[model samples]
Target: MAAERVEKRGEEEAQTRLPDLSFVHDKLQKFQSKMVSDFEQRLSCMVEDVLQDLRQRELRAHEFPNFEKSDRKSTWHNRVTNQAPADVSDAPNGHANGTQPRPPLQSETSVRKQRRQLPEKVFVARESYLTALLQVEHMRTIYHIFYIILVMFLLNVICYDYFVDGRFDLGLGTFRGGLRRLHWVLGVWLLEHVFVLALYFAFRGWALVRHRLKPHSSLQRFWSHSCLILYISSQLVFCFVSTSLCLKFNLPFVSACVLLLESTRLLMKMHAFVRYNAERVLNGKAKKEDAQEEKEASGRPFVPPLSCYTYFLFAPTLIYRDSYPRTSHIRWKFALNRLLEVVAIAFLYAFIHERHIHEHFGQYGLEPMGPSQLILKLFGMMLPCAVIFLCGFYLILHSWLNFTSELLRFGDRMFYKDWWTSHTYDGYYRNWNVVVHDWLYEYVYKDMYTHVFRGSKVGASLAVFMISAVVHEQVLGFALQMFFPVMFFLFGVVGVALVFLMRSAPKVMGNIFLWFSLILGNATLISLYAMEHYALKNCSLSNRSWTDRLLPAVWRCYN
Candidate 1:
């Protein structure tokens, strides 16, 4: 009876421990398999890389025969001497000690040396013929046409305002109102600089602290993480405060837009700075293991130069680099031309807003509308809307950015590519805003592809589009003080679909499609938004319902 009880107890204990042991065994097996797979993949990549190096060497040899021969001879002699056995000697008959000579073996160092000797390929910005034409003296006669048309429009607007309103004002009342709000705008601008300067100093101080600490220690890592969180939190607080002030003060639309845009840019700069430095620190740590030199592993934390950071704040780029290609001198005449163009375009925008946009859509719900009337209204607004769109693009992306770049002598003038002539929607998106696109590509797309989606290009692409669309919609919605999702839908859905479709189409057809889509999309946005904006102002609702307030007024203007 005692033996039976002892046996039963033993059996129960064995059964209880079996599952735990098996679970651990299963985990180990999985880990082993993963390690093997990763090792195989790495080995395969290394082999491929070596093969590619050989092929490139062959191509270079064909292109430069004399240089290639000299390189080959030197490499062969080094290999033969270094690797040859002490007993073996070179014979006159190309033999070693009466035996056939061994073949020359390429060393990893020699391959690296060859790679280092290869010339680096330089990238040049490709501008369209039209952009180049704008620089020519004779072609610049085209500017006078726009100037003449602008003057005529101004005259007509002045006459209409004076005759209709019995006032000789050129909308100076709005200008004066904006000026009154200018002090608030300047205050917010100053606050942003203060926040940025504080963040920079914080980073510098943390770097100094890190340099004094032991590498990879728990205390050091904890402090580093704490500082990172603090910097990010501070930036978030700054953005929140800045945005609240802009909304609270009811700043001018353009002024609010500029403030928000600059705030976003500063945040981007901080992110870039942190990301770049973090990578450099990680790389430094990684190289330390294989460095074999005391100088290479001196244990100093990576800290970016203050001047580089300052320059990046003013530079027309999102990417952070220690330095950039620069021109020797500023082009004063070109800078002046661009600045003047920006001012002229600003006035042109104001005139359009005062005359055409307001006149057509100011009384949307006051009048009964038929389909024909709506169609005519949209058609009439299309040309003016297109002109506004083009002028805004030229003013900001080309004129303003280029002017700043020239003043700083920044050499990368390709702020935008030839987006006007882009054959595909994907191409257009890439070329339209190279600065923003680079940020998205590096941080969003690449990060998603690497970490989240794990190499799913489609998933990564979708993430990028979603992020871009949301940011764009946020900008427009906040600036306009409206909750319209028209731009969001167009950007995220229609634009993405067009990217895929236009990707495979022929150049001519794709370009035509691109332009047609642009025209239609811009027209639709202007028409719908304008109608809704005016309807909200002019229409009086019978019942103050949630639907009436939340939904677009264009849908129920008659109600």
Candidate 2:
């Protein structure tokens, strides 16, 4: 009985031992597979290194022609053969020892090279000069000074108005007047959005249609070009019609100008989108000829997703991309601060208009004017004009745009560069509005260089300046409801001349000159325009002939 129990216990032990044995076997199989994978990876790395060395050797051979070809071949052969260890060489079906040839390394190397050459489409940290500047104590102090000055100006205006008129008006009446014209503004704004959406969809749909058609067919090409031309024509017609209606109805010209500017901005963005995608599509088609190419190599279809396009429409950027670097969370405090700044700036602007601008130019054009009075007026307006210019810059380019960018989590905050420190007019122009500058650089200047001028940088630059000047003049003309070429001549001619003149000046002197020129320019623009505006308002234009009306009231209103 005892012997039987012992044998039964041994059999039970054996049965338990079977699971342990199986587990050990499974672990060994996994370990063996891992080892094989690790070995293969190491071997692949060695092969790449060997290939790179061979390439280096080939390059050296070219540099030193005295190196014999036979010596080079021998060196290459020895290096390749010795790259593998004896253990690897002895393995069954191993590639070493000349039994099996190594796989072609060209494709893998090419892929790696292509990846290395790919452009980064996002901003790096600390890329925005303004954002960085705002962090510095000195710059922050300067900003605070400006804010205090603006507030003080606002208070002075309010007190002066109260003392003179015996009323507690804060210029809300002007605001109310603008509010009454809000419908016109809203209508135009909505129309612009609708037009942009329509254009986006039309472009996307056309691209899809082209895809379905035979590749490179004349019908497809003709239709695509025709649609593009028609779209451009429609945009031009919209601008003219909007301007004409504003003039005819005597609508709020400022609101009309805003609408026109917004429309132009959207049109430019749409053009960029179409142009960028067209190139992408062409490259994709070229890559698609090779069946073995990766899908990414063939590139994305020309039609961007609607969600992306919509986001881009509101994004504080002119360059369109499917995706951008996004912040993890919205900084509500920062956004609110910027918005509050905008409000303060708006109030300051209103105060300036009521006090300085309306007080001086409220009556008429350079009437009863002597040389002394004209000079005094120009000098007096300089500081106010500079403040206005600064406020305008901060409100639009920095605060408002930054607020939008933060809300949207747009990572790139470089809407403008260090334009304040610009030593040349060209530099200032390039840095003043980076968003617009980038668009001009990429689309207008580059296109001119590539297509129209055939690499004439001067021609491309001149073309860009002309286009910018014309657009600026159009905005100014529409806003003021006057046919003024002051902005055009200043920006296109004087600005261009200064760019070359200041190009070689000492940095400190150039910056001083830049500020001086800017202050003088702003003062001149504001004074002259204000005079003309009030002249037209106060003077009897009904008695004037067509030629007289066409001429600036500033020039002949005194007569």
Most TM-score-accurate candidate:
2
Which residue pairs clash in candidate 1?
none
Q: For each candidate, what TM-score against the reference?
A: 0.72, 0.74
Q: lDDT per residue, candidate 1, 1-559, as tens digits?
A: 9999999999999999999999999999999999999999889867876886698688656643433534443222211231311233212222222123444777899756544331211212222223454655555677677788678777976898789988876756555644557777788888788777777778768876876788789998999889878876887787778677777987766777887788888888878877766776645542244556447647666566688889988988887766655666777998998899897887777778788887788888988898888888888888888888777778888889888978987765666766887889988998787778878876777678878988688999999999889878777667666678898999999999888877867666788988888887898888887787677678775547766556777777775
In model 1, which range of ten residues has the least summed lDDT? 118-127
lDDT of 2 at 398: 89
* lDDT of the candidates, in the order given: 0.72, 0.73
Q: What is the lDDT of candidate 1?
A: 0.72
Q: Given candidate 1, what's the lDDT at residue 163?
A: 91
lDDT of 2 by residue, 361-417 (tens): 776553577778778888989988998998888889989998998898776676776
**Model 2 RMSD vs true structure:** 27.8
Instruction: State, as a TM-score between 0 and 1, how close model 1 is to the true structure.
Output: 0.72
Q: Model 1 segments beyond 4 Å from truth?
A: 1-131, 136-144, 162-168, 171-174, 177-180, 285-298, 540-549
